[model samples]
Target: MFDLDRWLEIFQTINKNKLRTLLAGFTVTLGILIFTVLFGMGNGLKNTFYTFFQDDAQNTIFIYPGFATKPFKGFKENRRIEFKNEDLALLEEKFGDRIEFTTARISKGTTVKYKSEYGNYTVRAVHPEHQYLEKTIIDRGRFINENDIEKDTRVATIGRLVEKDLFGNENAVGKYFTLNKIVYRVVGVFSDEGGDREERNIYTPVSTTQLIYKNTDKIDQINLSYDMAIGANGARRLSRDIKKVLKDKHNIAPSDRNGIYVESVIEDLEQNLQLANVLQIIVFWIGLGTLFAGVIGISNIMVYIVKERTKELGIRKALGAKPSTVIGMILQETMVITMIFGYIGLLIGNFVLNSMGNKLEDWFITNPNVSQGTIIFATVILILSGLIAGYIPARRAARVKPIVALRDE
Candidate 1:
């Protein structure tokens, strides 16, 4: 098992053709490196998508009006559909127990001013239940309450960014801000959201926004939260029921080609996650194909090396070396070269991923690291490739007749 002389001979042969050996080894190494990097990037993208989806309630549904694509009830195509306050009230009456929270929204992009400081931002009119649907945590004070909605108070909640820009470190509550020259008292400051879009909004009661903006009966959107106790399938069924009700009330057919649009966040997220998994599998196969090509190259090179070294092998056999001993020497050499270079490639790939992963994550890309399972799997593949590449050439050499091998120049 411990044949120092055999190993020395193998090393000396490789040393004589250092450049050629290195080139072959490098090809295999680079293939593995590319594979590792690509696989890591795929995983990272999957993680990023999953993280963003996690921030919102999985069972939430959004409803908005869009242009009708087909005529309905004598109305021409391209008619604008609009939802109203009464529609939201009707849905709540019918599905109150099944729904966790419901909110009607009317929003506009307008400039908000506090004293001398001003910023352009979106303002939304919402009910107290909007907080339950969004489940957003407040950093200071509290969100809108039922009293504010009932009395149509002119109080507002400002996002963290707005507070910082207008009031600096000072307490924002009790400060007055103006939108469209109408003043409203700031009642609360919302928490920062890592620069999420919602962090720039200014929120007030639906009734107050209607009165001030002079669009009292119109609403831009409606958001609903279904009880998690309902389960995902049940939530989906409830969404369909709600959609059916809206279509019927609006005098639109159930199969109307153009009508109100209902979007289920859960369904969208599930579809996206499935797509991400498929993409990861595709990336893995591409990387493996590249690595397989490299293994084939190594196998061909080893075959050539053995053919060229037939005379040396014949001399060894003539000196009483067993067939197993000759095979072991060649296998050992191949494995050593593969393990050393393969590991170097793995380290280099990991280093590159680590350096870029954080920057990508900041931009909302997820994990971005190759999993331990994948790395272990790759290592096994490398070893097996090396053994197979070496075994074929070694076996051919072992079968050669010493007389014939020695006859060659």
Candidate 2:
């Protein structure tokens, strides 16, 4: 078991054709490297998608009106459809319990001013629930409340970036800001989210918006959240129910299909996650296939090595070397080459992943490392590949006859 001489002889043979051995090892290394990198990328892409959806409730739905794609009754194609406050009120009455939170929004991009300092940005009129729907958090003061909506208060919540630009470090709560010369009180300051356009917005009550913007009883869009207990299927059913109510109220056909749009956030997220899972599987298989091919190449190279060293093996056998000794030498050489290079590939892949993970995380992608199970599986594959590659050649070497091998050049 501790045959120093046998190990020395194995190294001497491998040293004889160092370049060939190295080339074979390199193929395996390159294959494993590609496998590791591609797996990391797949994980990154999945995390990116999840991050994009994180800011919004996974079960939320958005309703917006667009031109009719299909002509219905006497209505012509491409006719514009508008949503009104009455439509939202009717939906709330019909599906009150099915809804978690509901709000309507109307946005205008205009300049906001306080004294001499002016910052131009978007202003939104939203119901109290808009804060929860959009995942808006207050840095100071409070968001729009039911009291503001009920009384049509001229109170506004500003984003952190807007606060810094208009007020600097000065307290903005209870101060006043004017949008389009319509005075509104600043009741809150919100934090920013890097590239979020919403972070620069100022939010006010939907009722206040309609009154100030002369949009009485009109809304551009409706945002709502459904109970998480009402899963994707239930959400889809509720969306259809809402669509039917809108079509009936608007005097549009149920089959008109284009007069209004109702979207389920849960449905979109579920579909996207499914697609991501498929792509990840494809990535894993491609990586494993490449690694397997490299392992096969190593097996072929070992076979060739056994063939080339037949005479040397034959001389050893004639000098009382056992078949087990010959086998042990070949197996050791194969394992050493495989484990060393395979480990190197693993280390390099992990280093690359760590370096890119942070930049990817800022974009909302999560831990991009291969799963522990996957790593363990790959290690097992590596060990088995080495054993198989070595075993076949060792079996052939043990079969060689002293008389025949001695005659070989």
Task: Please give the RMSD to the true structure for each candidate, in Å.
Answer: 2.9, 3.1
TM-score of each: 0.88, 0.88
- The digit string of per-residue lDDT tens for model 1 on 1-409 reads 4678766876787789998789768878987999999899888888877676765677788888877667667777776889889989998999999988899988888888888999899998998888766666688888888898888899999888888888888899988889878899999988643355777888899988887766567899999988889887887898788888887777675676458888787887878878888988999999998888887888788888888889988998999989998898888888877877888888988998888856877755565789899999999999998898789999999999898889877
lDDT (10s digit) by residue, model 2, range 256-341? 77788888877887788888889889998999899988888998999988888899899989999899988988888888788878
* Whole-structure CA lDDT of model 1: 0.83
Task: Name the lDDT of candidate 2.
Answer: 0.84
Model 1 clash pairs? 44-368, 48-366
TM-score for candidate 2: 0.88
- Top model number, lDDT: 2
What lDDT does each candidate get?
0.83, 0.84
